[model samples]
Target: MSSSFRAPPIPSSDEIDLVALFQVIWKQKKLVLAATASAGLIAAIYAFLTPPQYEVSSVLRPAAINELDALNRSEIYTLPPGDALVRVGASLESYDTRLGFFRSNQKLFKAFEQPGRTLEQSFEEFNRNSIELILPDPKKANSLSAYIKLEMSYPKGVDGVAILNGFVDYAIATEREQIAADLDVIVKNRLNELKGKIDAARSNYEVDKEARIASLRETDSLRRAQLQDELKALRAQLKTGRIDRVAQLNEAIGIAKSLGIRKPSTPSALGESERNGSSSVMRTEINNQQIPLYFMGVEALEAERTVLMQRKSDDFTEGRIAQIAKELQLLQSNREIEVLNRRENEDLFLAGVQPVRAEEARLRNLSIDMSRLKLVTIDKQALEPLRPVKPQKALIILLGLILGGFVGAFIAVIRHLVKTRQSQPQSAALSMLSNSPTMVGSDTGLNKP
Candidate 1:
């Protein structure tokens, strides 16, 4: 007896209460199937009938590293540049920007070419959901604020994605090309202006030189002419032989005759001889007066002319003109080159200091080629969602099931309480007895039990 021990009964799978489970399912089969099918159908419908989302991404490139560093050093960046890359960053991240991008008047016209809905209705739908816009981090550089990511959706079956993408691309490309071309034109015009200035400067230098030489020559000629006039006046004053002197001589002769100095017919010969002598004397006097005047005038004229000629000769000489012209000529010849260099130097100043202004165009082009981001590239590709993310069926089903089960359980509990109350009669009797406590007397009189 001490050695004997009974073996515990082994439970068989067949003996398990499968029937209970089957009964429970059969009793609630419609509920279970209905719940599950409703959930599944809703899920399928949401998946198939609901529109598929179209994700659109627009990229922006960060400002160049060197430019960013330079801007950082500048005092202006403390408040952020009006044209800074960061300024656009906020817009890129704003909900309004995204919303405006999708439902903006411009975009609306581009996409649908009409405003079918009222402003409120359009805004309502815009807010309700159909678009997602974001600015993703750049992939390569750290300090850049570069990319703009956008997504817009219409009901499934509409070509909204393709149409929207085409519009956006066209607009972006056109804007970028126009800006680039405009910048190129500005640079070319600036270069041409510099060239024109240089040409004008050269012309000024040459004209100024010629004017100076001409003035010097004219002054010299004027001096020479003045000296010649002085010489002409001096010669006119030196002329001899006067009619008054001859009249005085005849009067003296009549006086001598009245004094009775008798004369013969030879008086004519005498008079002739005397007249001849007078004429000779007059001629000698004239020679003496005019010779010195002519010689003196010639000498004075020579001196003045010599002085002026000396000065003029020195000033207008080919060698002298050549020497003076060399500087002007050199300046003129190099004017274009110098001006070009000066312009380049100015550009270099901007390129070195506010390179953003100069390189802004280059950066913009690069941005167009790449994107409008001024941020470092942290990631290149957009975040791809795992699923369509709309009409989450499992969640919907869970919610439904919980709600249904709770209702079912509440009804079941209430029913169980009602059944328990009906099965117990003591309560009603107890309640009645409580309400009226009375004594019952038997026929044998008051008897104690």
Candidate 2:
């Protein structure tokens, strides 16, 4: 048997209902109004009841009269300007350091202290939420345009301003103390190094002086000993009377020649004068006759002794030994002058070091009283906030109205979909019953069979 199939009917333009969506929303209007009203009421209550916060801020530019410049002007020591300023800014912005400062000066912040809260706990809370440090742009960090901005928030307007001013004061004082410490370390180390150099120079000079003296003494002793040995040898030669023999021979020859003798023989007797010891004149006899002879040995020996003494004197006056002594004296004098100059320089350096140390100590003591040193100037002071900065009441209420409308629309759509599903089944059953054929004729035919 063949089966026939029919397609489901498509709706006409007029039957395709667009107004059903409006009808569904209209039916749930009460629910939408209730949700929106509830959200708006909650937002209004929050805006009215919540406490408002106030902000206090100040701008700080690097001061024209910096600590480093001040130190340089004082002439005690010089410090690098750029590095010093950067370090100062960094120290001021450091969280731990700032917190420590606040904790140490609890009396300053005591007005803000909450009941039943310890100072440490209060400081922790304040640091976490209230304090903010805005640094300069990274690209422009080295430029003079770089600056530090400090901001603080508090529940009360006056408290905000007071805390910010106190923070600024503390930061400046701390920076000065740090700079003074750095200067002290630098000056002390330089002073110690200079002292060491001076001591080493002095020690070297002393060692050189002693060596020069010892060398000169040894040279003088050797030369003097040589001259004494030569003198002694000459004395011994004169004492031996070797010069007498030659003189006696010469006298004999002279006497023989006077007697017309071609050959002269040895003198048989020679008489020595008692007046002169070995150098006395003597008479010689020739051919058994007494002949007066003058022995020139004594005179020659005496003259030779005089020449030796003159040479000895000349050696002492103009020889290498004298030259060596003069040269050594000159050298010693020059060395002494050099030593004196060095000592004078050392003394000057010592004098300079003393004042620098004293200045460093004075500065260090002054650092304890930060009022004496102002490292930074607050360019703008924090003023009392005129209006509350928190809650944003109008914005909050507007956002609540918008969000509530969207939530109400979504709930209405869901309700419409559920109601439509519940009515669809009943309509399908009623249409099926009306479309089926009547059962009366069918029952009569079945009973005849």
Candidate 3:
């Protein structure tokens, strides 16, 4: 007995029909052509209607002569040499500075603004469409020989050129102002430092001079006191009567000898003459003992006085004191000169500082002019663009054509799949109806007949 169920037939490789696929695609040819033509037409219309955007670009090499050098030559503020040019160039190319420049400059924004647009919106649009800054090679990034490329795009060719030129001018001016402001700060700081040094030096010198004079005065007072003590001792010895008595006795003895008295008589026991002579002999004996003592004391005092005077003279001689005075004078003079020199330097530095702003302004203006004159060369100036750099018509058309074809193929395949599924259900329903048992004269059939 055969089984009642039959398995569904699987399509073999040979049954995979390319001809059917071609027929289906042919049947949908109009839809394909319509899609293709519509895409082409839309692309053509967009290419024709959209305003052309012209781009203007300029190239700048690092200035051969530095901006700082120009300022120095102008006798303004001096700047250190290495990497200043590189730093400035980098600043000019910075995204933030560039964005700020675009946002702030009324003229640059004027070309890109639309009606009812806010400043921020206009800036956003301009930033998106307009400016591009190209830096130097990554390998030689820090090299001084590197360049900066600036590009600007606008709907109008003239506007593009104008905006670019204006931007270049603005960048130079802004950079100049920034450098000058920095220089002003540096100059002012240096001036303050010099002034402080001058003041400190003057104070030190004054303190040193006062201390030296005080030392001299103290030494002089001590020496004077010693000399005064020696003088007092000599005066006390002169006021004593012993020295006078000795001198008078020596004179009397000499006188007696001159009057032909061979021996000075010693007094006898019984007379007035004896009494006077006895007193004289006694006084003479007392005088002889005290005279030597007085003389020794006087001699010693005189010798001491002489030594003291010599020492005082040596210690405080006119020449030595004068030498000290001269040395002090010289020291004071040198200090004065130093103070004066420092003061002068301070003044000069202040003088240099005072006009720094004006000088920087002047030099900055000169630098700007020099930059314009190609001293700091603009390697290439932006030219008016001859053609639009956007709205690439050929590429747009080709892409549209490819997209249309893909869309057309997708729609056709979907339609084919739906028709295949519907037919399968209908055929299965027909098989069921045809295979249904037909009883001979069934009740429902007989009623229908």
| Most lDDT-accurate candidate | 2
Tens digits of lDDT, candidate 3, 1-449: 12233445767857758888878888998887777877877887888788877788987765555544656575545444324445556566666666667776677467666899987787787767677888777876576566678888777533677677767766766666677677667656655665565566556655665675566566655655555554454444443433454554455445444433333332231143445654433322223332322223333444444554334223232344444445444443334444444553333433234454444445345542333322234779898776788787888888788788777867887888798878887787777666455433354566783
Candidate numbers, best TM-score first, in rank order? 2, 3, 1
| Every candidate's lDDT | 0.45, 0.63, 0.59
Put the candidates in lDDT order, highest first: 2, 3, 1
RMSD of each predicted structure: 17.3, 10.2, 11.4
* Candidate 3 CA-lDDT value: 0.59
Candidate 1 lDDT, tens digit per residue, 1-449?
A: 02122333545757747575455445655665665566556556665665554443434444356434433443222223324334344544445544455554444433333357765565556545654555544565764444555565554344554544543444444433444465456556654655555555556655654575566556645654554555444333322112332343344444435533332213333455566753332211222332211222233433444454334223232343444445444433334344543553333322222333434443334322223523322233333444444455567667666665555444444554576569666665665565442333232244545
lDDT (Cα, tens digit) per residue for candidate 2, span 132-169: 88887787657566567888887743467767887777
What is the lDDT, from 0 to 100, of the residue 243 in candidate 2? 46
Instruction: Tell how far residue 16 is off in model 1, in angstroms.
Output: 33
Clashes of 2: 0
lDDT of 2 at 246: 46
Stretches of candidate 3 above 4 Å error? 1-23, 65-82, 93-105, 114-121, 136-145, 241-377, 413-449
TM-score of 2: 0.62
